[model samples]
Target: MSPGPGAGSAPASLTATDKVSTFSSFRVRNYRIHFFGNAISNIGTWMQRIAQDWLVHELTGSAAAVGITLALQFLPMLLFGLYGGVLADRVDKRKLLIGTQAALGLTGLTLAALTFTDVVNVYHVYVLAFLVGLVTVVDNPARQTFVSDMVGPRLLRNAVSLNSANFQSARLIGPAVAGVMIAAVGGAWAFLANGLSFIAPIIGLLMMRTSELNPAERVPRGRGQLRDGLRYVGGRPDLLWMIVLVGFIGTFGYNFAIWLVAFTDQVFASGPGTFGLLNSLMAGGSVVGALLAARRGSNRTRFTVGAAAVFSSLLVVASAAPNFVVFAVLMPLIGLAGMTFQVTANSTIQISSDPAMRGRVISLFMMVFVGGTPIGGPLVGWLSDEFGARVGLISGGLVCLAAAVGVALILARIGGLRLRISLRAGSRGLALVPRDPEEVTAPAGAAIRPVA
Candidate 1:
C-alpha cells in the first residue's frame, strides 16, 4: 500500500536490507546491549503482569480489584509524570534507568518471596503495585527519551518501532511462558523469573560503551520549564490533537489487559492457558502493526487518526463476538489497530518536538497515554463488576469511536480542511486542503522542522 498523506511523502518499502538496517541502532554497542537487556527484562515484566493479575483474581475473584490494581500501577504516572519528564530533561537517562530497573527487580523479588512463603495478601499486592507505579513515573519517560540518545535522529523512528516490535514479541512469548510456569511451579516462580530477568538489562547497561552514546541535548534548568513544555505543545495544533486522540483511546478504549481477564474468566469460563492464548493472539497482531508502521516511515498524522478509527471499530466488533474462537480470530485485528495508533502517535510526538524540550513533551505524551490508566482502569473494572465484561469492553470501544470522530472533526475545522473517508485501499481517503496554501507553509526560519 502507498503511504498516506498524514505519513508525509515517504515510500512504502520493506526490503531485506531495510530489515537489517532497522537493527543498525543496535550497532552502537551501547544500544545493542541495551536492546538485548531490555528485551529480556521486558519479558519478565510481562510475566509479572500476567502473574499479578491472575494472582489478584485468584485471591478476590473480583474484576474490580484487578482494575484497582491496574490503577495503582499507573497512578504514579498520573501524579508524577510531568516531574519525571523534567527529570529526564535534566539527568542522565542511562544512570536513571539502572536505578529504576534495580528497584523494579527488587519489587518483583519481594512479591515473589511473599507469594512463595504463602503470606501474600490482596493489600500486599496493592502496595507493591503502587510502588512499582511510582518507579515507572521516572522509568518510562527516561526510557522513551533514551531511544533518541541511543541512535540520534537518523534512525529514531526505526528504533522506536523496533522497540515496540520487541515489546509485542515479548508479549507473545512471555504470557504463554508465564502461564506454563504458573501452572507448573505457581505464580511465585513467574515472579522470581521476572526478578532474575532484570540481570540482563543491568548487565546491558553496565557493559554499554557510553563514550559512543549520542550526545543528549541538555536543557537549561529553569523555573518555568514545565510551563515552557506545555506552551510548546499548545502552539502546535497537530501535536495537541494527536495527544488528545491518544488520551481518549488510552483512557476509555484500551483496557484489553483488564478486559481479557474478565472475558476469559467470566465469559469463557477459561483458565490461565486460555488467557495467555488470547493475549498472544493480540500480540501477533501488534507485531504486524509495528512492522507496518516501520515500513511506512515517519510523519503520518492521517494514518494515526485512521488507525485510531480502525482500532475502535475492531474493539467494537471484538466485544460483540459470540464465542472464544471468534474473539481469537478478531484479536489480531484489534491488536494491529491498537499498535498502529500507538506507533504513529509516538513517532509524531518524537519527530515533531523540539530537541531541548523533547523529554518533557514526550513525558506529557506518556502522561496522557499511560496516565489515563489510573482513571480508566478502575472505571472499566467497576463496569465489569457491576454489569458484565462485554459491557465494559463495548463501552470502551464506543468511547474510542466517538473520540476519533470528534478529534478528526475538530482538526478538520481548525485546519480549514475537508476530510473524506473512503473504503478504498492505497488511496488518500482523507485529504487536508487549506483554503489558502500560503498559510499552511512553515514560516521562514521557524524552529519547527517539517516532518519528513
Candidate 2:
C-alpha cells in the first residue's frame, strides 16, 4: 500500500541538522544533464505557449476563441491521463519519453509549417494543440517519475524544486524573446524555434549512462491496475484532500490566459509586449518561490495549505487593482504563493507515496490539477466576455478561498485538531491544537488513519 504524508520510510535518514543544500541534487551527473536539457526545452515550450495564445487571439479577435484553444490542448489529459500513468509503470520511461518528445516536436513543426504557408487558420491551431495535449498525457507522468529514476528518493524534493525553478527561469526568457520575435517576424518563427529545441533533450536522454541510473521497479502488465490506484488515493485523506484543493483552485483560480488577454486588450489597452512583461514578472516570483521551497527542510501540509490561501487572497486583490501598474506589481506575489503551494504539494505527495505506485499517484495528482482546465477555460472565457475580466478573476478567487478554508476544517476535524485562540499580546495566538489521540484513532466516518 502507498504511504500517507509524513509516513514515508525514505525520509527517516535525514534529520533537521542534515538539511540538504539547495543545489545538492546537481551532484548527480544524470540529473545535471536532465536539468540543462529540460531547461532549453522548457523555454521553447513557453515560447510556443505564448505565441499560440496570441496567435489565436489575433486570428479570431475573441477571448472565447483563446479559451477554446486552451480547452482543446488539455482535453486529452482529462481523458487519458490515467492510462498514461499505467503505461509509465509498465514501460521503460527513458525510451517512452524519446518517442513522446519526438511526437511533440513534430506537432510544433507542423504548426510552424502551416503558419509560414499563410494557410493556417484557427482550426489548424486547435488540431495541433490537441495533438500536443495527447503527447502530454503520457509525457507528463513519465517525466515526473524520471526524476526519481535519476537522483533516487533522497534528492527527489530538491530536484523537483530545481525543475520548477528551471522552468520558471525559462519563462523569464521565453516570453520576452517570443514577444519580440513575434513582433519582428511572426509567431511562425517562435514555433520553428520550439520545434528545433527538442533536439537538445533528445540528445541529453541519449547521452545518459543507463548503468548509473536508479530506475523504479516496473510493474508487470495486469488488469485492475487503474482501480488499484484509485483505491490507494481514496484510502488516504492527505492525498485525496490535497488533490481536491488543487483541483478547485486549478479549475477556477488558474485561468490566467483568458483573464490576461482580456485585461490586456480591454482594460489596459496594450499588446503582446505588455502581456510578455506581465508573464515575466510572475515567472520571476515563481523562481523565488521555487528556490525557497528547495532551501526548506521539509514539506509540511499546513504550509502548503497556507500558501493556497495566500495565493487565493492575492488573486482577489489583483482583480481589483486600480491600474495596470498595480495589477502588474501584484502578479509576483500571486506567482510566489502559487509556486510554493505547487512545489510543496508535488514533493510531499511524491515523497509520501510508495515507489512502485509513484507514477500512478503522481498521475492522479496531475490529472486533477491540470485536467480541470478544459472545463474551466470556456466558463471563465464566457464570464470575461459577458461580465468582465475583473468579475471573472474575482469569482475564481472567491471559489478557491472557500475551498481552502473548507479543506482546512475537514483536515483538522479528521485529525482531532481544534482551533485554539489566545488573547495574550505578542503571542502566536491561533493554532490547531491536537485533541486526545484516542479520539482520532478512528474518528466517526474519518478515512484518515495515520500511517505508523
Candidate 3:
C-alpha cells in the first residue's frame, strides 16, 4: 500500500504543504477569522497610539509626557505580567480574552469621551493608559499562547510570523490613516474608532467553533506554580540568552516613540503629520520583514542573535542620517531589521517552550520584552531631553550592539560552538558546529551530527 506513487498524496497533505509555503496559518478556519478580525483591531490600536502621542504632545510640549503615558500603559505589565501569565496557564484563554478586549474598549471610550468633552488632559491620558495596560497585562500572554491552540505546534512559526505580519500590515496603514484623521478631525475620533474596533475581535471569538481548539492542559490551583514556572525557564540557557538579548533591545533599542517625537519636534521641526508618516514608513518595512520571516522555516537562535547585531548596526547608522528625508528613508530599513530580530526571538521562544509551561514562559518573555518599557521609556525620554534625539538614538543602538556581541561570545564559549569552514559541495561558508558529547575528542572536520 505504501509503495504506490499516490499513496501519500491525500488532499489534506497537499493543503497542509501548500499552507506551509505561504501564510500557512490561514489554512485553519478559526485562525482565519481571528486573523482578519485581529488585523482590523490592530489598525485601530495603531491609530489610537498615534493619536494619543500627538494629543499629549499638543497638550504639553514635552517629549517626556508621551513617555510617561507609555510608561503608565506598560507599568501594569511590569507589575502583573508574570501573574497574568500564571493566570493564563489556569484559565480558558478565549473567554479571558473576551473580557480583556471588552475592558480595553471601555478604556478607549473613556479617553474618547474625555477628549470630546474638551477636558482631556495629560493626567486623563495617563489614567486611561494605565487602564489599557492593566487589560494588556492579561491579554498579551493569553494571546501569545492562544496561537498554539488555534494552529497547533507544526505551524506555530508561520502563525507567529503571520500574527506579526497582521500587526505590521495594520501598522503600515494605521499611522498613515491616523495622521490624516488627526489632521482632518481630532484625536478623539481616532480613539472612538479604536473603541469600536474591539467589537470585531469579540465577534470573532464568539463565532469560533470551540470543539476545534486544541486546548493545552491547564495547571490546577497550587502553591508553588509560579516558582515552578520560573525554575523551568531558569533551567534553559538558550531561553535565558534569548530573553536577555531581547530584554536589552526592548529596553534600549525599541524606544521609537520617544526618538520619533524628539526628531519631529527638535530635529526635523515637523508636525504630527510627518511624525505619523515616519511611523508608517517604519511599519511598511516591518510588514516586509514579517512577511519574509513568515516564509522562513524553524526559528533558530543563531539567526536571532545575528539579526539583533545587524539590527543594532542599522540603528547606529540610522541615528546619523543627515536630514529628515534621509532619516525617513532609513526608517524602513531599520524597521525591516528590527522586525526580523523580534519575529525570530518571538517565534523561537514560543516554539521552544514546553506546552504545559508555554503560557508562563511566554508571560515571562513578554514581561521582559515589553515590561522593560517603564524603565526604558522614561529613561530614553530623559536622554532625549538631556542630550539630543540623535545622541539618544545612538546611545540606545550602541547598547544593543554591545549586548549582541557580549551574548554571542558568552554562548559560543559555553556551547563549544566554534566557527568552521565547510568545503562540502555548495556549503562553503563559515558555520557553527556544536560539538557533540560523544565526539568530544574529535576535531571539527570529523563532525558527528551537530547538536540540536
**Which RMSD does model 3 reach against the true structure?**
5.7
- RMSD of every candidate to native, in Å, equals 6.2, 3.6, 5.7
The lDDT, on a scale of 0 to 1, for candidate 2 is: 0.86
Residue range 274-323, candidate 3, lDDT tens digits: 98999999998998889899898775667788999999998899889999
Write one digit per residue (lDDT tens) for candidate 2, span 393-438.
8988989999999988777766678788998999778988887777
Q: For candidate 1, what is the TM-score?
A: 0.90
> What's the lDDT for candidate 3?
0.84
lDDT order, best first, reads 2, 3, 1
| Candidate 1 lDDT tens digits, 66-157 | 98898898888888888889999888888999999999999999999999999999999999999999999899889988887776665678
Candidate No. with top TM-score: 2
Q: lDDT of all the models against the reference? A: 0.83, 0.86, 0.84
Clashes of 1: 3
Q: State residue 255's C-alpha deviation in candidate 2, in Å.
A: 1.6
Positional deviation of residue 325's Cα in model 1 after best superposition, in angstroms: 0.8
Clashing residue pairs, backbone N/CA/C < 3 A, model 1: 6-300, 6-301, 7-300
Which window of 10 residues has the lowest lDDT sum in candidate 2?
A: 1-10
